[model samples]
Target chain A: MANTFLDRTALNDLLNGACFLGGGGGGPMSGARPLIDLIVKEYDGVTLVPYDSLDPELPCAVVAGIGAPDAATHGPSFSSAPKDAFLKLQAVSGTTLGAVLPGETGAMNSIIAALVAAQLGLPLVDVDSSGRALPTLSLAAYNLATEPTVLTLANQPVTDEQQATAVIETRTAPQADSVVRALLTTQAFEQEGAFSTWLMTAGQLPGASVDGTVTRAIAVGAALREARAAGDDPVEAVNAVLDGQLVRLSCGTLTAFSSHEGGGFDGYTIVLTDDDGHVVTVSAVNENLLAWRSDSDAPLAAAPDTLAWLAEDGTPLSNTDLRGLTAGTRLHLLGIPAAPILRTPLLAARFAKELAGIGFFGQAPRLD
Target chain B: MANTFLDRTALNDLLNGACFLGGGGGGPMSGARPLIDLIVKEYDGVTLVPYDSLDPELPCAVVAGIGAPDAATHGPSFSSAPKDAFLKLQAVSGTTLGAVLPGETGAMNSIIAALVAAQLGLPLVDVDSSGRALPTLSLAAYNLATEPTVLTLANQPVTDEQQATAVIETRTAPQADSVVRALLTTQAFEQEGAFSTWLMTAGQLPGASVDGTVTRAIAVGAALREARAAGDDPVEAVNAVLDGQLVRLSCGTLTAFSSHEGGGFDGYTIVLTDDDGHVVTVSAVNENLLAWRSDSDAPLAAAPDTLAWLAEDGTPLSNTDLRGLTAGTRLHLLGIPAAPILRTPLLAARFAKELAGIGFFGQAPRLD
Candidate 1:
C-alpha cells in the first residue's frame, strides 16, 4: 500500500472503520472525533507510512491508551498521555524512536498513534500490533516476539497532586499486561492511562505486527461512508470491501444488556432476539469475546474473529456507544475474519483464556 | 558517633531496638530476625557508617520494604527485593550510589537497608529518612527536600511469571508514595515489595535526614537486653537510655484487638485496661498513630511520638507479635517523643493527613 495523508474525510472514515473493527471495545468515537479534528486543524493531516518502507533498523514503539473506555470520563482527559508516554519510553530506554505504531485497532487508539506521530514530526507506521481491538496486551501480535517488552504508562492528572508516570520492563507480554492493569486501579490512574510498548526496530515489525491495518481501516471506512451517502446497505458495502469475508450472523433487537466496570475493563453481556425468534447472547470484556445462539451449543464466533454491531444508518457502534442503546433497537451483528497473523497458535492461546473467562471454552473459530 | 561493624550480637540488638522503635508497623520482627541472622552468617555482618562521614558529594539512596506487614506472609519472600530495587534504581538513575540509607527505622526495613548495603559492598548510613517507621513516605524527613524523589520498586516473584520491577519518579513525596502504594496491589507485588527512594548526594543528606538513628536503636536494644539479663524492669532501662524521655503510660491487658488489611497497610484498633481500671485505646495503621484514655479527652501520645508494647519478659512486642496475644494477657504501653527533626512544620503537614484518616482531626500532639 502507498503512503496516505489522513485529511478530514479520510480520518473520519478511518475512525468509523476502526471502530467497527474494534469488535466492540477499542475506544469511544466521541473521544477520537475531537482528537482527530484537532490534529487536522493544527497539523493539516498526519502522514501514514507503510511499515516496510522505513529503514529496518529505525526504532519504533506502539502507542495507545490502556484502561476502561467508560472510565475515561471520570478522570483527566487523555489528550497528553500518549505523547508523554512516548517521550518517557524514549527517555527510559535511551533510544530515539523513529516512528509511532498503533498498539491496537480502535477509533481512539489508532488515531492517537497518528496524533503522536504528527505532533512529534514522525511517521505513523501503517500497521498495528493487533488487527482488532483486544482486551489485553497478551493478545497482541507483538506479544509473540522473543524480545522483552518495556512499557511506559502516563496519566494526565486532573490536578497537580497526582503522580504522572511509571515505567514497567518485563521479559514477557503477559507480565507487562498484568502490571499495567494493576496500575490502572491506582489513585494516580483510576482505571485510565496512556501507554507506549513493544519498543523494537523497524525490521522486527513485519514479524510482530499486522501490516496494512491502517489502510484497511480507511478502506472499510470509505466503503461505509460511500454506502451511507448512496442510501445502500452499509453492511453489504463493508462486506464487499473485505471481499465478502464479513458474516451476517444475525439481525436482532437489543433485549438485555448489563455492564460491570473494574480492573481496567468494561465487561458486559448483551442479549438479543432475532426476527425469527432466535436469541443470541454476547459476552465481552472491553472487546466482544463470544457470541452464541441460546438454542445451539456452538458459538457463532469467538474472539480473534471480529464481532461487530451496526446501527440502522450502517454506522459502527462500539461497546461504549452500545451502553446507551435501549431495548428493541434494531441492530445487525457482523463477524469478520481476523487478520491471518492473529490466528496463529501463539495468539490463539492468549484469546482462549479471554474467551474462557466469559464461558466459551473452545478455540476461536475462523469466520470466513 | 564512631563507625561500627554489625556483629551478630549487635545486629540482633539493632533488630530488637528497631522493632521497638517501629512504633507499631516498620515491618515485623519475625521477618527481620531470620534475614539478619542470614546476613551475619553469610557476610559476617554489615558495616554502619555515620552519614556525615562520607564524602559530601557521594551519591546515596534509601532502601526499604513498602507494603502491609501482614501481607508478607502470603507472598514471595522479600529476601531479594531490597537488592533488586537497589540495583534497578542505580541502573535507571545511572548513578553509582556510594552508600545506602535506611528509608525508615524498623526491624525489617532498617535491616533490609543493611542487607542491600552489605550485598552491594556499600556502607550503611547511620542516618535515616524517618527516625521511626512511618506508614507512608510522605512523613519521611526526605519528603521536605526540594528535589524530586525517584523511587524504584521490585518484587521477587514466586514464579518466573511476574513482572519484577517498576520505576516511579515524581516532584513530590506524596505522589511517589501514592504511585508505589498503587503498584503494591498489582499481581507482581500483591502488597509486598522492596523499594529504593530519595536518591541524592551525601551533601543533601544532613538537611533531609535524622542522624545517629541506627546507633540510637542499637543503644535502646542493648538496654532492653541488659535489663532482661539483669532481671530489672526493661521499660525503665529503655527510659534511662533515652535520658528519661520514655513515659510509662499504662500497664494493662489486651482486652480487644481488631485488624483490617488492604491498600498496603494493616489497620487496627486495640483496647487495654490498666491495673487502676483506666481504659486506653490505641489506633494504628502499620505503625501506632494515637493512644488515648477512654476517660480523658487528651491523647496519651500520637505519632510521630512512639507508642510501644513490652512483654512480661521485657522484650519489645511489635503489633504483629501483639496479634497473637489472647484477651487478658499482660502488656505495658510506653510513649517516647519523636525525634526533634520530625516535628518541623513541613513534616507535620504530611502527618496531619494520615492522622486525620483514622478520625484524629486535630494536630498531632507533642508527647513531651
Candidate 2:
C-alpha cells in the first residue's frame, strides 16, 4: 500500500473524485488537467506512499493552490509554471524534503500534489490536510492537527509577471496561516485569482493529514466512471462509494444567485425552489458552507460537513461555474460527512463561528 | 565636515528646518522628537558625514518612517523598536553598511536617520534622497538616485507590542517598496501608522542624495528659531535663510478642503481664497504636488518644487493638521525651489505624469 503507483486510470479517477469533493471550490480541472497530463507523460508514473511508511524524521511539504477557484477558468491561460515556491521552501527551510502532501483533496489539489511529486521525483503522500476543500488557510487540517515536530514554511516568489512577494517562516501553524491570509490582500495577490500554498512535513502527516484521502478520492472517481460505462446511474455510483453517506437533499431549479469577491474569497448565496414549492438556500464563501430548508432555521448541512451541488447528469461545478447558473437552471443537491479529523470538538470550534458569520452553521460530521 | 558630530543645537535645527521643507507632509515632530532626544541623551552624540568623503565602495542605507504622517499623532505608544529591517538589509545585501542617509528632509525623517545611526553605531550621511519631502517610496532620493555601487535591502518586521516577527528579503527596490506598502494595509501596521523604510547607499549619495541638505535644514531651523527669539518676524526670518528664494505667494483663508486615505497615503485638495479675492487650489497625496493659481491651467508650484502652507504665526502644517482647518481659516503660502538633482529632466519626468494625474503639474525650479 505504501508503494502503490498510480497509472493513468487512477490519476483520472483521482481528478474526477476530487472534483466532486471540491464542493464548488478547488478551481476547475480545465486548468489542472493539462499540467497533470504533461507531468504523468514525462515522468512515466507517480508514487503514492503512506505517511506511516516514510521516515518519521523526514520533512514533507503541503502543495496546493490559493485564490478564488474561478481564476484559473478565466482567460489567463495558465501554463505549468516552474515550482519555484516548492524549491524556495526547500531553500529557506534548509531542509531536504522527502515527500509532498496535498494541502487538500479537491478538483485540482489532489492531483497537484502528485504533479509536484512527479516533477521533484518524490512520493505523493496518501494523505492531505483537508480531506475536502474548504476556503481559508486556517481551516487546513494540518492547522488543526495536534502539534508535531514539523514546522510550516509559507513561500511566495516574486516572479517577473506576478506581484506576490512574501516568505513567512513560523513554528506555529496559526501564525503561518494568519500571515499568508494577510498577504492575500496585497494589490498583486488580491487579483492573482489563484496562487500556491505549501505547508507541513512528513512527520506531521500521521497526525495532521486526513489519512488515505488520496486513495478514497481515486476510489470515488473509479466507481463513478465504471458505473457510467456499465450503463448504471453515475450519481448512485458516487453514493455507493461513500457507503450511503451521500444524502440526497433536493432537486430543484436555481431561483436566485448573487456573489461578491472580496478578502480573497468569492462569497455567494444561492436560492433554489423545487416544483413542489419547497425552497433551499445555500451560502458559501468558496466551498458551500451551509444549506437550509425554507421553513427551518436549522442547517440541513454545514461545514466541515459538505453540501455538494451538481447537474443531475453528475457534472461537478466549481463556484465560478455557478456564476453561469440562472433562474430555472436545474440541479441536484447532496450532503456528505466531512473527514473524521475535522469533526472533533476542538477542530469544530476553530472555524464554527467563522462558518456561522457567513450564514453557515451546524455540527460537523462526527466519527462513527 | 565628513567627521562632524551633531550637537543638541544642530539636532533641533534639523527638525525645525525639515518641518519647513516637508511640503506639508513627512509627519510632525511630536512623535519623532522624543525618540531622537532619548537616543541623543543616551548616546551623547551622533556622527554626520558628507557622502563625498566616504570610501566609494562602501554601501549605505536610506532610512525613514513610512505611512500616513498623521498616524503617529494617534495612540499606540511606540518605544525603540528593533531595527530588524536595518539588520535584515545588512544581512540580505551581505555587505557591511558604512552609513545611513535620511530618505527625505521632513519633520520626523530628519531625526529618524540620526536615531538609527546612533543605535547602529554608524554615521548619518549629510545627504538625503529627497532634499525635501514628497509622497511615496518611489520618490525617495535613492529611488531617484541615478547609480552607485549599491544594492537596496528593504526589511519590514511584523511587530506586535513593538517586537518584530519576520523579515522579507529582495534585491529590487520597487518590489521591496511594494511589499512594505502591502504590509502597511495589514491590521497592525494600518493602525501603527509610521513604519520605517531604509534604502540606497553612500555611493549613490552623490547622484541621488541632496548634498548639504542636512546643514541647510538646520540653518533654516536656526534662522526661524533665532528670529522668533529676537522678536523679529519668523516667516521673514525663514525667507532670509533661503537668500530670498522663498517667494511669498498668497495670504488667504481656506475656503474648502477634502481628502481621502488609500494605499497608506492621505490624498487631499485644498482651496484657498486670498483677502484680495485671489484663489489658489493645491493638490497633494501625502506631500504637496501642485499649487494652481486663479483661473490658470499652469501651476504656481509643482513637485519636485516645494509649496509650504503655514499658520499666520509661521507654524508649518502637515496635511493631517490641515484637516482641522475651517473654511475661513487664514493662512500664508510660500514656494521654494526644489533640489538641483530633482530638477533633471530624467528624474522630473519619472513622476511628473503621476503628479499630473493627481492634478499637480508645472516645471520644477531650475538652477540659475
**At residue A1, what lDDT does model 2 achieve?**
59
Q: Could you give candidate 1's per-residue lDDT for residues B117-214 as a string of tens digits? A: 88888999998877789998888888665443678999977767775899888988788878888888877788889998788888887778888889
What do the candidate models score in CA lDDT, each in turn?
A: 0.82, 0.68
What is model 1's native contact fraction? Answer: 0.00
Chain A (candidate 2) TM-score to true chain A: 0.87
Q: What's the TM-score of every candidate structure?
A: 0.51, 0.47
- Please give, for residues A1-368, the per-residue lDDT of candidate 2 as tens digits: 54889878888888878878877777677756776676668886699988888888777777676666655566243333325456666676677878877878777777777887888999988987767887866676776544322332222334566523456665554565556556655665543323234445466666566888888889888987787778787778888888878877778888877777666566777777876776777777778876766544245666887777777666666666767766567887778787777766656666675553542222333213
Instruction: Give the poorly placed runs of model 1, Cα more than 4 Å off.
Output: A1-368, B146-148
User: In candidate 2, which residue pairs get closer than 3 Å at backbone N, Cα or C atoms, i.e. clash?
Assistant: A60-A201, A60-A202, A66-A195, B62-B199, B66-B195, B129-B141
The candidate 1 chain B region of ten consecutive residues with least summed lDDT is B356-365
Clash number by candidate, in order: 1, 6
Looking at model 2, residue B341 earns an lDDT score of 74
> What's the TM for chain B in candidate 2?
0.86
